[model samples]
Target: MRRLALVLLLVASGCRNGGAPSTEVAQPPQTVRNPVPTAYPSEKGDYAVTELVHGLEHPWGLAFLPGGGVLITERPGRLRRIDPDGTVSPPISGLPDIFVDGQAGLLDVALSPDFGRDHWVYLAFAEPTFRGNKAGTAVARGKLEGNALKHVEVVYQQEPKLSHGTHVGARLVFDDEGHLFVTQGDNRVAAAAAQELDKLTGKLVRIWPDGKIPKDNPYVGKSGARGEIWSYGHRNMQGAAIHPRTRALWTSEHGPQGGDEINIPRAGGNYGWPVVTHGIDYSGKPVQGSIGRSTAGMIDPAYVWEKSPAVSGMAFYTGGLFPQWQGDLFLGALAGKSLIRLELEGNQVVHEERLLTAREERIRDVRQGPDGALYVLVDAPDGKLLRISPVGR
Candidate 1:
């Protein structure tokens, strides 16, 4: 793999409350790379798809930089930068040791909301235990220097790391109040952990950028409950996006055989997982311990799929390029192998459209670029970064 050292313009760390430390580095000039374009038709209109770059190894998370650059994370513990012109940089250095195994490793990446000023980058990955036998999801942040991260520190870690590998929900999102939300999945072997307030598994946690637990967090003073927890009882959430109009945090979760869900998680909310679900087990039997589809204390999903699409990344389209798609929700589907677009009437999904079914690619992540176009990452050994723009625009 190419390991190019490109310097990024650095600024003084104006972080409050002793945030991640910063370093001084010089910036480099920007250049554009040629794009290979393809066209496709969608429900709203025809669009052109351009392959900006390729050869990524199971790229999972993607975050856009201030000046059209993108930071992408590969599942096998590598981070790369993609320039606007389609140039992919080499693996960035300074990441913590990741526990790479089945459905684990370097996962999601996000820029601090104040990235232009602070240059802080956040990451979620499967962190290994001392013995290297058990692992759990962890969140860390660092200052983005030239071609590496500096002063990286783990902000939060899941308690009681487990030996299993699957169901490590690792999506990161920042709410309107600047609070960071980290999604966690119930490590497949511990489904009941989702219902326990003492466990971080299968829960969404809210914290300050500097790792401080917010005083107003749902369980701050509750006995035996972790203060960072915001909501619980999720299976394996992989997609999260802030709603543009309502400013609420929305997420997509994977179901067993069916019953994939989209939820607007609220403070202290509990969306039933093992206790209740619409999906059956992989063996075609009912989910173990599930009493019914709905229960008295457990909150129901805002929307659910009778068939699992295996949703991953998600974004709310507020860009001008797709005016008709404004306020619509777009989710990347792994098993469905397409980009799923949902027409939303407030919080409800009114209509649905599946795009890129012809390509049959496992869409890993999706975001609307600053240029008013949609960008998606394909999950594969030879993954691609593709930009979708309205036809002839």
Candidate 2:
């Protein structure tokens, strides 16, 4: 009884003097990151879509915390946080020097496999060179402390940073074996680099989480070949996800005019980016002397979209909130302004469904949160973080 009275007295005194922290968590800020009620139609009927966080500028990546928080990365080189209670924090400090160019900046963020215990996070960003003019994709590892990143370290960097912005493919994926895969672009300045064995650009690299080359990687001991190369001859690949059942790494990349492709990448494979494409150049001319769609030695995509939708981020749905969506792949589209759902049977896409067409939001990143809910980040001047769940679930 005395303890209860003392607690009540303390609460009263704290309220009177405004000195004690409230037991109640802070509410979502009214000016920013506020919940905006919205109803959007989907194949499942009218569903509930809530804008949980707003006022973000061109958000590119999102990762949910196991404890109920979220980390959002803005392409303009800022990393923001959303507390468990829905309060958005200011940009966390201690990020590495980011080269914020046209298509480059702080990109993807992923929690380490042992993140619950180690609290280590990884980021992919466009990094600058010694000259301070050229830049390319790089990966860094850091420890997340209170509200700042501590003990940050650069783990991997693509060589020969060039001075362009359109194609710094920056997606990070982790396999079950703890190997990290990084997707890079052709750097735009040299498309031929994609076919070269020595260059790291325009390729998928396999490395240990700490940036060491995996000994079993396809190119590990090959002379004149970068040791980290897992698969070569890729264009600007930005979206990659591991299939839940097959454990295969599937990637989607941008094509010239209309040859966006979805591929199941293979070890030491050549994707024939510029050599053979169904797309045409920006000038409406056939790509590279009309190389046709196939070559004897090059591999073909598992699926090709004749009309490019500008696919961005992707994830395989395994949540029970939407039972019908299990085993399907969800891809965010920037130019198409919709969330694409692809029904997969084994390794083939059986059917495709477009969702959120009415909202017409440029979905930059799509992720399945820890709570079995779907989260998407819109890319815009006034970007928003959205949560998607069943109407009454």
Question: Which candidate number would show the highest TM-score if scored against the true structure?
Answer: 1
Residue pairs with backbone atoms closer than 3 Å in model 2 (clashes): none
Q: Which ten residues in a row have the lowest lDDT in candidate 2?
A: 1-10
Candidate 2 residues 154-270, lDDT tens each? 999998676366688878999999999998888878878888989988889999999999999998888999999999878888788899888989998888788888988899999
What would the TM-score be for candidate 2 when compared with the true structure?
0.90
- Models 1 onward score TM values of 0.91, 0.90
For 55-76, candidate 1 gives per-residue lDDT tens digits of 6667788887876566777776
Worst 10 residues of 1 by lDDT: 9-18
lDDT of each: 0.82, 0.77
Off by over 4 Å in 2: 1-37
Model 2, position 2, has a per-residue lDDT of: 6
Candidate 1: deviation at residue 295, Å? 0.8
